[model samples]
Target chain A: MTRWGMVIDLGRCIGCQACTVACKVENQSPVDAWYAPVVEYEVGRYPDAQMAYLPMLCNHCTDAPCIKACPSGALHRRDDGIVIADEEICIGARACMTACPYGALHLHEGRSGELLGDGTRNTPSILERYAHERHIEGTVSKCTYCAHRIDFGTEHGLTPGIDPEATPACVVTCPTECRVFGDLDDPDSPVSRYVVEHGPTGVLRPDARTGATTAYVGLP
Target chain B: MSAPVSALPQNVFMDRWALEPKTQRVWGVNHAGWFTLMGIGGGVFLLGRIFDITLEAGRVLGLPIVDVVSFVTIAIGGLILIADLGRPLQAWRAFRNVRVSIISWGAWADLVFLTFGGLLMLPDLTFGDSTPFSGLGWDSHATSGIGRVMLVLASIAAVVVMVYAGAVLARPRSIPYWHSVAIPIQFLASSLAMAMATLMLIVVLDGGDVTRSELLATAGLTAVLLVTIVVHLSTRTTAPGKKESIERLTRGSLRGTFLYAAVGAGTVLPIVLGLLALGFDGGAREVLAVLTLPLLVVGGFLLRLDTLRAGIYPPVVSLLEAAQR
Candidate 1:
């Protein structure tokens, strides 16, 4: 079975936030929402002051708390260890929001469109074509690891990590190539090879025991 | 041990993905209020059953007042909860995932309680001794049997409702302050205390004598509330996230609420009043009981609010920084 995972190399990340923009455009998330947000923080001080950027997203854990907390089973883990939310089934209870330690899940309140004054836009943007059917007011949403692309890629006999078209928007758009997407189960996969070479990859909130799939290299 | 380094400073060595510490506002006053109201409703029903079993004081104003309170509050609470939902229309989905979701179980429990509690009160509200469905051979004796069954079922459901509120919060691994065994116990104690106070108020208002035993029980439960709070605060966990949450509660921004509302007003004041009621007699005792009841109610609500507010997300930067240091 394929356990989809990601490896983000912090040393290679330039804090450019191009990945964030790509993810937002790909997901067509609300103006306020960013599926992958590059959180920038200052490190060091005085003349040695430097800025660090950390792009945050859903970890898609094996034992996801959001799945357990969802009263309606709106959030569930796929066979391949990808955690996805069924927007239609979500009752907006926000239990998953509290359950997620990563602060990845978000609720849509039907905010005004970026270009329009009445919380809407005259033209249907590119994201509208691939928008989830239940993407309406008062539903919880989160990153799906671009499941549509992955599924389509698999059907077309293309590799997810190696094929540019099959990969996640963030990974494809990352100028510094800091983001890597692949199957953790496959030892020869880029993510696995990267982990083996760089060694001692870090998962966020390991103590949370959610069995996070997203690993980090050169985190600190 | 090396001096504990604070994670608040901007220039800190931490994980690249470390997020700034922020309290989640996913569940606000609506969630807290629903839990508070439901806890009281369920607690009242459970206490009423104890009263029926022991004191045979089930009827108030020629009706089961506790049953009435349960019916009203649970119904209102259920509605409030539904209204709080993003898709209120799809709330029926909450009933599907019963095995894993406490929310599903809670919905089912509330429905059961409401059904039985409503049936129990129907006889009094309707034709009294004369059976409304005599043609169906449903007599007063049969109705009494149904009421008895309702009483048992409602009581069980009531207990579930009380525990469910805390259990839902406890299930989340993120907020360590909430994910504790002590949270449910504290909620249970607070629920019972609030119920007893409400019952005392009702009895006093109805010109009934406030029993010394009831006052003592309230006091005991108040003590339980205090002890549970202390235990919840003091219990050590290996999770540093939990430790940071504890700090936020005891000495951080939420300290005023914890000190004044939850501990002082919610626990201590009620205990003092219960004690005074136990010592005093006649109208003075009744007055004290009345005063104690609202204090407990407000305190209970504040306690829920305090718990909600004190819940701090595990500081990603802090944990990573500590590991590096």
Candidate 2:
């Protein structure tokens, strides 16, 4: 009955990349791995130059192509509408990487375990100790919408979108409060209300027919 | 009072209209190469088996070259596929999910094809006879019947293995170039063309006469390959991203590979050489056949590589541009 989604208000986003840093810290991802990245591009010519930023992450589509493409069934969708990849079962065929039009999925090449030229390692000891769920070598990884935080918050009688503790790190860290996360199916939810108020929100590659859950307002 | 400068609307719109660069493909030349070999090998064995059954051909000379090529290439392809995996050890899990995954079906099909193809070739290797159980003094008729059954099963599996390679790539809705219905059909036609070319080469080398039927088959398959390429290129895509991908193949960065290697050398050159071989005689014909075969084979591989390379992800900015349009 629950379909989790995100609404990004491009008009309000300053594109400081605070959310990107917060996501990396919260997830303890590898130096090369980015769970959320802000894609910045120059819009105009010299006299009228402008920069536009688009934050990219997994859309977690209702009809996920990655789930169908995974030969090992390592990628699956939960009942709550979150799509996840099981690292243990992943054979690293990179099928899902090709299947995703958004370019959200990434392969973790185990660079985190590599020794540096001076015999020092790049991955922090704290990350090694606490980020056990971080992707291992030869496995595919992607954003999970911070399901762990949501589940934990729900168990503790807190609402995910309303409570900072229950929300995704990127959503919580956004300075402009541009990111909205809530159940799309619930008419009363903030995400659904935002969509209704804004009148029109665009999903990436709607032509892909993947039924992307993430929507954006004022994308241009 | 001084005022802050801001970006113009036209500049913002232009930025939103710009197409993003192509994403890095996970399936690259290695995957393309192995899949092509597998399709060619499986197709040759299946067609050769069918020919032997219908034409009453016997095991001539010593080696069953067609069977050997079939089993070897498929085996090697299967190995390469496993090695290409990030976690090669977990490849066995491919069989766990067959309902939705073309890759899972491909793995199972490869297994069946190899097993049955190997079984069909057993009597030839062991007893030097066309019939299984002949060394044991069993009824030759019964052994032949069993061989036919095995050949039929192997051929079915071989066809599936060949098509499944294309199916796996085609099923991804993301890449418009590979998502077309023509892709699998094109792959199947190219596989058969490669198989026929290989067969022609082997026959010519072995001093066996290149039969007219085989030449016709090769020509027909080459024609199919050409038509499919045209269809694949001409087909209109609904999305701007897909249209951009098509442009990349027809006129953009991938044009050299698509036009020169895949279309020119692979399809057109082979067809010309095949036709010229039919016109020539003696050593001249053999030379033409030999030259023609490798071109077709290489072309097949290049076609796959071009398709893989041309797979452009849907542009993120296209969503914004669509509203303006």
Candidate 3:
């Protein structure tokens, strides 16, 4: 019954990519593939220019289209409400990724197809990264909401099995505290309370009707 | 929806239509090419079993070595499939979204089953003696439980392989002509159709006597093709302007293939051959069925080839023009 949600305060946001780097390193995702990306856009005429950055990731829709489209049953929503994928069961089908309107997923490559030898095609320094782990050329991956860490959060003394003390890497790394996470079902939770405080002017891409659990508050 | 000059404009010929000799020749060759490759895989498996046959007891046909054959055949089939795709590197992009795309899901389904099938066939491939003769890959000892577990998993994947090919191509949204849910049914129908046809053709060409089972297979395949056509016609849906587009094939360029190969030789002729044997004894009827199997197989291939060729992408340009109007 507990649906987790996030409240992102755009007013206090800065476009610094610390959150992106944190997510990448924490997830150990390849440099080319980003679990979270900040999309930059410019608005208004040149005389009165303004720039904005929107950090995009899985919206984790209630009626997730990705789940319904997966033929292999690799992607499934867990009892705790997190959508997870069984990599072994996945057939490298990209249907779920395309079904996502928000462009949330990416295919995870397997170790089977990685290049064997150090290359002179790129600088020796650039070759070091490739020497680390052999890339597997055919699997899909995305944010798991740091579920492993969150599940063990109580050991860090924030809360016992209820709310994990270690926030999502992106949220934890945000200097501005722009991203807030908590249970939407709990009226006392910070995210739920923030949404109740802010009005309709707050949400992003509401028309997509994903019933996005994450919210963008106080955006002009 | 003005008629295009490329098409004949009607279903005038009915059952008289046959596959263009060009396509007929090409299809036969194409199918044979694929079958030959599968035979190589099957041959490897048979070799594995023969090595074990002297050591084991009863049946010649049900030897677990068949798993090796099944694995090689499926892998060869997989290769043919990848080669057929217009883009292979971009093929990985198919997995970009599993939730909404049928092709992506189909790709996944095919891979899982294919991998499982390969794993089941592996002990033979490796020629490892740690296992024993049983079911394809099943009779082996469990020196390592992982292989046994994989065999179970592979069996499930084998079924998926059969089902996915049909389901994926039969996608409702992506390919307009392939829209019917009956497509997978058609696909299964066609695999049998082709299998029997090829078997009969090889027997005939090689001047070998045919078996009763092969004849029955032909007859059964003909019935399947007939049922598939009915199912296809009944289950199909068309967009508002698509009727005109579909008309290109129904009455135009594609009409010949659909009418002759798919309907006549593929469906009707095979049915007639089956019926002609109704009054005859098993030997004669069986002979007739074997003779007709190749034609039914041709029809099944036409269904896939013609449908693939005839399917149109949205007449986006025309639609855009109309919208502007």
Candidate 4:
């Protein structure tokens, strides 16, 4: 059982929003919607202050708070520790968002179709931008770790599926090679080795027992 | 206002109409007045507690004035809700399904928050010679336990409170606005905002106020407002009905509620006040803090009230109009 995790090196990060754009395109998220967001914090005062960007998405904790908070089991943490949302079953409660300390989850509007006055011939607009694909509202969304791509790591079994293409879009597109994604369980994995070489700070809510898989290392 | 003691006509339809509706018959006092008083009292108690927690961190032994007041306010609010109920004992019946009922969770959360408050006060009452607790008499262990329990229960109650508020307005099908994932976020955000506002109002009315907490209150209010805005903005792609409701909130007659209350007062005002206070002399900061407190509270109240009033109750509104036609 491979547990997936990502190591973000704040030292190498340049505060560019490439990861944000990459995650959006890879996930086909709405133009205005955010799956991976880069939040910039200005530290120190005036001239001494430098911008520190934290690119965030679902940490996919082993014991996810979002999953526990959802009254409707719309959010599920997969066996691989990738938290996924089932849009159809979601009641749009948004308890998950409140529970998420990182503020990674976003509530996407669910649309079945527009009901005409006569209640027929529904007009669809989700495809208006995407050209054919339709995404609904009333559903919460977050980074899914691109499970489909990771699942088919190879077209015909190339290199044991080890971090080859298993890295998330955000991880792959990081300009300064700040983000690292691989199986946390594999000691030789880049993410695992990075964590071992330089101890990283895991996400901690006030409760501090959520057990976040994603770690932020060498935050400047 | 008192109802006129007019005699009912003997005709069945006329007599039925003549009898005053249960809602309209004055309970000897004004309904709006009672609601206002209740709101004010509860608001004050809530604010006091928040100030105590934010400023002092609740580190010292014994109950803070805010904690005692908050517990009392909660109990009073619970009683009001029960009084409004048709079958008050059925309140217990609500607990039968804690899994599904937000109301049930709210009741339990209230119980937990209050119980913790009371238990903390117990050691003080035992006549221990501790400084803060010496007034009453709680032991150090008892105080710690009480604090820990209160902290956990308060966090849980916070969510339960929002859930109960949102559940009242939520309908998955119709009024698209209420159907969005932002329902709980809005409710939770508004509750915290109101809680902060209520605290500020009480501080304004009371003497010997702690000014340092004004900063913390502003910070808390600002954080919730930012989150609320994020949630509200995310609803643009919601169902047409919901989108229309959001339009009403942002651009229509209901825009005042969103603009003045949620945005201007709740968000911008608090941030500006906090920042302004940082630059001012003590005297000016004190005055500005006093001024901004009410604005924040009013903002919170207007936010909740507007959201409640503007909520589309769906087929009820349409069906009633159709029936009249």
Interface RMSD of each: 10.4, 11.9, 18.6, 22.8
Better of 1 and 4 by TM-score: 1
What lDDT tens digits, residue by residue, belong to model 1 across residues A1-220? 8999999988888988898888877787754456787777766565776777677789999989998888998888899888998878999888888888887887775543333433334554545433523366688788889988899899999999999888999999999899989999999998888888886788777767898998788766
| Isolated chain A TM-score, each model | 0.90, 0.90, 0.81, 0.83
Q: How close is every model to the real structure, measured as TM-score?
A: 0.88, 0.87, 0.46, 0.43
Report the C-alpha lDDT of model 3 over B242-300, residue by residue, as the tens digit.
Answer: 34335655687878887777778777787677667665654575577566756765676
**Docking category of candidate 1:** acceptable
Candidate 4 deviant stretches above 4 angstroms: A1-220, B1-63, B125-147, B162-164, B167-174, B194-217, B230-234, B313-325
CA lDDT, candidate 3, residue B295: 70
- DockQ, candidate 4, vs. native dimer: 0.01
Better of 1 and 3 by lDDT: 1
Q: For candidate 1, list the clashing residue pairs, or say none.
A: A112-A119, A113-A119
User: Which candidate's TM-score is highest?
Assistant: 1
Worst 10 residues of 4 chain B by lDDT: B18-27
Docking class for model 4 is incorrect
Pick the lDDT winner. 1
RMSD of each: 5.8, 6.8, 13.9, 20.5
lDDT tens per residue, model 2, B1-325: 2212111111111122324745344677888888798889988886775555212333433337777777889999899999989899999999877989888888898998888777665544444445443363222122566666776778888999899988877887777777877888889999999988887777766667776677777878988989998987877765555677778877888888889888898999888877877887778877877787888888899898887777766676664453343
